[model samples]
Target: MIEFECIQCGTSLRVENRHAGRTAWCRRCKRPVLVPVNATPIADQPDEFPTPVPPAQPVARPYFEPSQPPALEEPQETAMPAPVKRGPIQAMDTDPRNAALLAEIERRGRVIAQLTAEVEALRQAAESRAREGDLLEAELAAARKMALSGVQDTGRERAMIEELNAIISTQRELLVEKDEKIYKLDAALRRATRYSAETDGNTELPDVPRTLEDQTEAGGYEEGAEGGDARANVELDEARRLAQHRSLEIRSLRNALDDMAAKFDRVTVELRNAVLKLTETQQDNERLVSELASARDRLREKEFEGERFSTEPAQAPAESMEPALLEESLSSPVQVEVRPEPVWATAPVPRPEPVRAYSPPVTTPASDMPAQPATDIQHDQRVLVDALLRFLGRR
Candidate 1:
């Protein structure tokens, strides 16, 4: 017999032997399915009398029974099998396999213990390494940050340097302008000096020609006739006067030129010195600025070093002993004297005397006293007495 089921509905199907190798439809679902030759038919007959179904109950059972009072059946004794002859018993210590096994177990245990210790050590080492790595990472981050800060600071410093350089360049340009102005002024003064010198030299040349011209003009007769010689002398005098006036004007002009040249030279020298001093001052200022920056850098380095020193951990107690040892090795003892002395050893100082103010004595007026006759007094005596009286009165 063969079993057949509907593919779609999973329903059992039965077919006659003659209907083998034929297609059929499910009776329940009406699904087409193939019928096999060996299909078994499910029985559908009902029992004539039905048996009562038992009610569900809990099964009560015990794993083990209690001891029995006695056995009801006689126990039968079967023949025991004869013991087989065997080799002499071997001592556990003499068993190489067991010993080897135990040794191997011990070795394995030791290996396991070592491995466990190593694992624990590795764990601690890993933890330490991790901590170290974390610290290093933090340090690296800090260093990176510091480096970036340094780079920024460097950029700022570079900018500051550029600004300073620009300022210096501007100052230099100003100095160059000042120098140019000074040079121009000096050249001007030099030209003025040469001009004044030439003028002075020409002035000193002589009043000889002017004096001769005046003498000749004075000796010559004038055109208007009066007393001829007298008129001529008068006209000549006037001409000599005119010639003197002209000479005086020339002298004045020469003096004026000399004075102007002196003034120019003086001003030029002063300006030149001033320019030199200004340049010196500027150089000094730059030197001072450099010194100030160096001092600040040193101060910052010292502060950083101090911070590092303060942040470092203290030395161990054993390490601290070296200072004591050094102290002992280098120690020296010296006797100190104990002296007793009077607390008031020095003499008392003398006090200064008070100053006294002078008071002037009062004098009665001369009018209140008797006056001597003026007739009795000689002229010389009167002058002397008046002088003496005036001196005394003033005093």
Candidate 2:
């Protein structure tokens, strides 16, 4: 037997002298160690075997388990143990077969040691990934919470918008109703003016025609002219009174329209502000949604990598690691309940129509009948109508 200690782990190992000058793995550290040749003379050997085979490969040795537990700390690369030298090989019959066998054993030992190290590295990587997965799960939970809150906020905003829309529709209806009433009032006023003109025409029309046909002399003409002057004065007074009443009504209607317009403008401004707020909330909601999706995708990728790295039975099961929670969060839909808003067109406020004064036509029996009074009456009527038209236009 050849006795030697491992250079890396300092473990004592005993191998058959047939394995001399061969490399083997350390049972404790799993690193390759060179077995030194026996220094004792061949006469001291107890048993000898006949070696006749030239190309037969050496049999692989069975692996031995360590008596003690593996060390908790990993070996550092920068701090390697010094080599332990053993005595050189003793003089023997020079043979090519022994050299070839030793070389083969050494090569096999190196390959096994490299594979073992690779597996250890993979195991360490899997453990580190498991810890990262736990942190990702916590973050996913937080993101889910935030998304829930955003959904709730969006719901509230939609409700408020619905209420505003309802109010706007009602206001629109009220405006339409008011417009119809104003139009009806305008039509009624026009009918009343027409009827009054017709009545005045009926009253004054017969007198002028009768006077023109029956009067035959200058004395009859003078008496007719005097009577015409009195009638003209009465008509002027009636026209003035009617004008004042119509002016008051028009003024009141104009004030009402002004107030309604002011209210409508205020409502429009409020609607604009509400729309802007809704837009901002929607943008924020979209941003949050994108963030959630990205996070979900990242988590999925991490899960895939984790699955690939961890194949050991000793590692925790994927199901026990809260995959359901992640799936639930990712799969759950955020619903935004929406109710259709009524679109109501705003009606323009009705403006009061311009008032026109009506006058009956008058005729004189003779050319000698004084024409100055008739001309003055027509001029006064024209002035009053013009003033009323200006007032209504200004309003």
Candidate 3:
């Protein structure tokens, strides 16, 4: 440390050796001063004045004022008062009160610096929390999107299930039909075997008929008995094959339905978990928001306290004048302008009548009358009777 005195203000200054021969501004007077290459020790300097120097000591006392002391005393005293009056403008090294004031100012400065740091930390925390909230919100939106997709998937699965159920029902009906056909074929086969046993020495079975009607026709009776047996056997084989194929299809469809149900259940569970996470995130965001609000309130309170402390000395004179200003303001009467309500505001408004729906005018059909007046009367009576009967029947 290089200790030096500022020539401009005689303020004590300390700087590092690295700044030797460099020009720097004085902290006290804000004037540029050159830093010495070598450190200046306080002990080496002459004690030209007291360590706790008072600013307003006399420059010099008149040496020839021994005689006529009372006459010169008045002039000397008058001149000394000017420097005394300017005492507060100089350094405050002597007064205990000024020292206390300096200490308080320094303490307040430290407090302000600490508060600033705390506010910065709080701001950073709030910013981080806000970012976290945004991320959570985005996550929540993604969850909602996923949930919507899951719901759509579930609906699709339900529709698929319904289609499968319809298919299964149709298959059941087809199976019942096949069962009836098989029963009829077995009965026909039984009858054929009985006939064949009775006619064992007769002609062998012929080519299969396409339909029962073909075999039952009178012209086809010669070939009927043998052809009917062959046709029943062919139809029974076809029915059994179709039933087996249908059963395989139904089994595959059931497996597909079970797989879809499992997927639906898994999706449902995922959606539920997402909803729970969304709720928890919302709660955390709300808590952070409340904490941020409280922090803002505390920061505002701290700012207000700082402002009050800073303004206390300035407000002293204003507070002293408050009573006078209040009394003066009270002595005067304030004028206010009053406006009357508009005629529209006080008057009742007329309500419009409700409009009715338009109806088309009804026209009576022209009467069909004979040129003879007696015939016209009979025709009108008949028309009236028919109209009355129709209306009564409708009722």
Give the top-scoring candidate (TM-score).
Answer: 3
TM-score of 3: 0.35
Write out the backbone clash pairs for model 2: none
- Model 1 off-target regions past 4 Å? 1-103, 204-395
**Candidate 3 C-alpha lDDT tens digits along 1-395:** 57888999999897776788999789999989999887663433355544786699668866764565465544443343343444432344453334433444454455444334434433443344345345445644655565566567656656765665676566567657656765665666566556555666666655666787865663467666568767756765665676566667656666765665676566567656655655654554454445445444554554454454334331111232245443543353432112332332222211111111112222221133112223221232243334334333432
Residue lDDT tens for model 2, 1-395:
66778889889887777888889889999988888775332422558755687898999999998799777998677967898674332111143223433343344344334333434433343343344345445544555565566566656666665665666666567667656655665565566566556545654432343463454554576677667656655655555565566567656656765665666566566656656655554554455445444544553564454344333222112232244443443353422121221111011111112113332222222222222322222333344345334433432
TM-score per model over all chains: 0.27, 0.28, 0.35
Please identify model 3 stretches exceeding 4 Å from their true place. 1-92, 201-395
Instruction: Give the lDDT of residue 162 in candidate 2.
Output: 67
Sliding window of 10 residues with minimal summed lDDT for model 3:
349-358
Residue 67, candidate 3: Cα error in Å is 76
Give one digit per residue, the lDDT tens place, for model 1 in 104-186: 33443443333333334333433333343344345445544654565565556556556655655665565566556556555
Estimate every model's Cα lDDT from 0 to 1: 0.45, 0.49, 0.50
lDDT (Cα) of model 3: 0.50
